[model samples]
Target: MSEATANDFASLDAGQLAALRRRAILSCAIGNFFELFDFTIYGYFAVAITRAFYPSGSMYGTYAAFGAAFLMRPVGAIVLGAYGDRMGRRAALVITIGLMAGATGAVGLIPTYRAIGYWAPILLVLCRLLQGFSTGGEWGGAAAFLVEYAPPGKRGLTGSWQQFSTQIGAVTGSVSAALLASSLSEAAFYAWGWRIPFLCGFLLGPIGYYLRNKVAETPAFERAVETRTVEHAPLRVAMREYGTRMIQAFGLSIIGCIANFIFVVYLVSYAINTMHLPSSAAFSCAVASGLVVVVLTPFVGALTDRVGRRPLILACALLNLVFDYPLFLLAIRGNTFKSLLIALICNAVFQALYTGTIPSILAEMFPTRVRYTALSVSYGFAVVLFGGFAPLISTWLVDVTGNPFAPAFYVMTGGALSAIAIISMKEYRDAPLE
Candidate 1:
């Protein structure tokens, strides 16, 4: 806050710093793009995956296999999160993408259940574990890198690129799935065509790794390194020092994660199943929703820079609370264009108001030393708890209750929890990150 300190911070706002900032966002966003493209594509292809692996007529079994990966996320957070805190964000970013890409390509290589017996699902689970573990570290490091490297006035805009690229990944996955399913014969798709997307994921990993490798360590991290301020045991210090912030992070994260998984990933199944919509229609709807988010997220991020993160976040939660049930009802009203438009509207709201702010809000929570660790743990644990199994849970809720709109209640409940956390936490927009 002092004049000398302000001057020091301003020194990094030079042209070279601007270049670093752009490259940093570009690299981090690409990494996130690949991670999410792989992530969402798995969901998009879950039916084929289950038919190939589970093959028992239980889709939940497939979703459960999908959920199994998430259980490893918290563990990945602790291990790789610490690596990011200590070794540096760029190094951790490269490692996470390498693991993600390998597992993704491995998913394509596994033999079908009929071909390999139970080994098929076993291989699937193993690949999921690797993907989950690596994913645990990717977002935390990317968010830390972007927020730390960002110039003061542009943190929201730069950080928004993280989720902006996430929607790009989602859009790519949905569009790819739609095109593949539409183009391929049913027998061919179930047999081997589903593997193409996973195999394609191999190309992105190397690109993401190359980009992250080219970037410098964030200035905040470099300063910590120079001052010997890096914590040797980052997770321990994070838990001891920022327990409340971590708890708040979980609270804040729950609804956003639910909204994302539900609207983006789960909606594919929800439309195809509960509403009995055509697969192509459902896929097209998902693609439209993703495009909406991709278009709108950056504007929302810029708005947060002006109005601060708290208001938009709270507004997002409140809208979900007030409109979630109605939104679900609208989505199920008919298998028409109107139905898809309703879903797209909900996706737009979730993306612009909530998802856009996640990187900035989360990065601003803890100091630089333990920031990545805290974010990884809190966000990872929250996703494992709710986001990972969201589709499974939504499907189960519908199966058990026989209410087609049962998933709405889950998102609505998340809204209430998020409201409480937002009320409890400090509004830190434009505040010093460390």
Candidate 2:
């Protein structure tokens, strides 16, 4: 056996293994946390970005810019995901975090339309596209890193930290935006305050790079490398061997992606624009709702390890399908902080269950050689089609239909699609990773 495989993880004592797992989790999760924060802050400050970049009379331009990055995700997934399979998970993760940090920081530094005219929005879209590409590579690598390190029968619980860190990043973004908006004068906020969050996102890069550098590459990937099982063309290999599994992964992701974008990212806009809530109230509701996901998701993930993945996934999809419209109605009727909180929390509960389980399921669907490429491409496609533009689509749907509840139907449709997808999926909770 090669040196990489000769240093058997099985030789480590319990404490040594535990320490390694913790380091791996922290290394992977922090980068994902930063990546999510980078994206979440953009969504949180979309309105300010719209005013700053788009001289065009339409907010659609800004939303389109926001969605544009997602268009590059699949390309990134194919390119970077293959890089992970060929180079190593740690190398791909380190590169992704650096790219994300730089792209995110660039957004804060770009001159506004007032100064740069058309160049301002153009630069902003480019930054977003870079962010999208970086994120495309980050998620699958992180998921694979976490699951590959997980002890047998504990993959669900360990993998769930990926989502946990995501919620934490999102909550931090919401709270940061809320605090800045509440504390700064509207003139100051609209002037320069919004860029602060993006600038701070830049600082996350060095930290994530340091953390990832400290952790060893996953044993699974090391074994693949040692055994010469790493694919030279992982994306092509994945498509040829795992086409059906890729579709299953995409279907499994649809509702979670849509619901996350709508309930978590778009809800702030919905509260402010549709319900006419104060920005503070809107952000506060988002923070509370995100906290719900943050706290419950690990528990839900742990539960899946016990009860099975399909049950919770089915429950999440079915509940969202049935109750999304009613929950939207409940918020609209009262139009109060309490009602919005309740509605958002209910929506968040469903999201937590789905997010908690989906990462592990996606990671489990393919063999080590193509795991990164297959899962990332599948997820990137799903997010691009359903999640990435969800806020923009929801905004447009409500605009054209003149019905605030129209976005709820969009979310419900995702739930239905996901339900069908999960119904046909074989349970892989206890299956040994190849």
Candidate 2 residue spans exceeding 4 A from truth: 5-8
TM-score of each predicted structure versus truth: 0.95, 0.97
Backbone clash total for model 2 is: 0
- Candidate achieving the largest lDDT: 2
- Flag clash pairs in model 1: none
Model 1, residue 108: distance off in Å is 1.1
Tens-place lDDT per residue, model 1, 146-235, is 889877777887888888997898889988888888898978877898999899998778998898888777778877776778898999
- For residues 251-357, could you state the per-residue lDDT of candidate 2 as single tens digits? 98899889888876676676776678888788888999999999999999999999989899889999999999999888878799899889999999999988899
Ten residues in a row with the worst lDDT in model 1? 1-10
Q: Deviation in angstroms for 357 in model 2?
A: 0.3
